[model samples]
Target chain A: MITDRIAVDIKVPNQTRYLCLIGHIGENIARTLRNYSGDREKLAYDLNLVLTEAMANAIQHANEGDPDKEVHIEISIISQRLIIRVFDFGEGFDFKQYVRPGHPLDEHGRGIYLMHSIMDEISYQQTESGHVLKMIKDL
Target chain B: MNLQIEDKGAAVLMAVQEERLDAHNSGELKNHMLKLFEEGKNNLVVDLQAVRFVDSSGLGALVSGFKNASSRNGNLKLSGLQLQVKSMFELTRLHRVFEIYTDSDEALASFQQ
Candidate 1:
């Protein structure tokens, strides 16, 4: 029997103190795959940077600055792909479609645009649970 | 996050040595930058040669700091960004937002009229 699937789930209390946990997640998972195969290190680095940015956006903006809400993350490594799902119990914005040209004069509204630029596939959906962002990349 | 400031008459350089600038340290950086403005130190240069990554919140903090400086007759600049950290600006198109230089010396020299 070959085991090729892994999942990491966490429920953040929607506070700044908990934000640091997000930065370590992708790296930790990637570290665990040292002997597995493929460019696990690069995948982990990418996941770490992109996921932290996405989660930071959720914690800061999507919740309307609410710190009592719930933030959930689901990270799974299956076959040659890594899947990341970040959801929040707050109003969501349409970020995947936002585009700001490489202008050196604008400062805000670039998080989602960058996320899509880095992720291989990104999507969003609204549910009773609030707004969910699903992102996938091949490692 | 740690900051060291140097005032050069026409420009003030802020050297930042932080690994991650997400929500964890974004607020602190914001407060510090604001304090610089309070002291009338306006020519701001953020040294990110050590920061490997930055998130939206971190970027937001930088943006907020720049606005504050701009409102006070000063400017904010960036220096020594790694490829990873530099990409944040490219991805978000924020490379257009800051006066980015390769280092503090370069950024300081540019203040010449």
Candidate 2:
């Protein structure tokens, strides 16, 4: 039994070039946690699903809605709780406006739906700096 | 992603190769599938054996395929889900929404009904 602890924080510019940051965030946060469920496959999938959704969401809904502004992502995990905050450096999004389930035949606007469903709790705070979405998942 | 449609017996099978079927390619894939179904070819099966990663975007593509096929009086099934991709299916519980088989051949044979 090993109780090695770890932590990582990354900053990424909101350029489309940084799209792969989702994969990185998943790897970092998953590594940071010490105590986790023994099911390797389940743990991998759960972490991937949550991180990918959150990262993609941040990329899509950046603060100022600026295509070039950088989005800030800070993630930290302590024991069983994984906390992730994705900040967008663009204009704010109309959270209430895009919450609909959308048309059945469409393939977009489904990110938030999946994210909210998978994470234990997901909340968003929009400030003058940008939009910050914080998510927590209990392992 | 490379998408190929196969007409096997009574089923129309679609093979998706590459990484994503989301915002960038979902529209195109939907258009292609819809066009085929419109041509009276139903009974769709998606072969995802080559796909390693899929996100919400990918899920949306599968869902769109499902709705379109069902709406047209046909059905859609998925086969050959890799470990990582299969996790997405189970995580979303969309696995329950979809008919998954161990392989593409089984998925095709299932359309005999």
Model 1 chain A: lowest-lDDT 10 consecutive positions: A99-108
TM-score of 2: 0.76
Best-performing candidate as measured by DockQ: 1
lDDT of each: 0.77, 0.70
> Per-residue alpha-carbon lDDT of model 1 for A12-123, expressed as tens digits?
8877676667767887777776345666655555677777767776777678768778789998878757789999878887674454443344455666666676789888
Per-prediction TM-score: 0.82, 0.76
- Pairs that clash in candidate 1: A103-B96, A104-B96, A104-B97, A105-B96
Model 2 ranges with Cα > 4 A deviation: A1-7, A13-19, A28-37, A62-66, A94-110, B19-25, B38-40, B83-87, B90-93
Residue A52 shift from truth in candidate 2, angstroms: 1.8
Task: Please provide, for model 2 over A111-136, each residue's C-alpha lDDT reduced to its tens digit, 9 standing for 90 to 100.
Answer: 67666776788887877777788888
Off by over 4 Å in 1: A1-4, A31-42, A96-104, B67-73
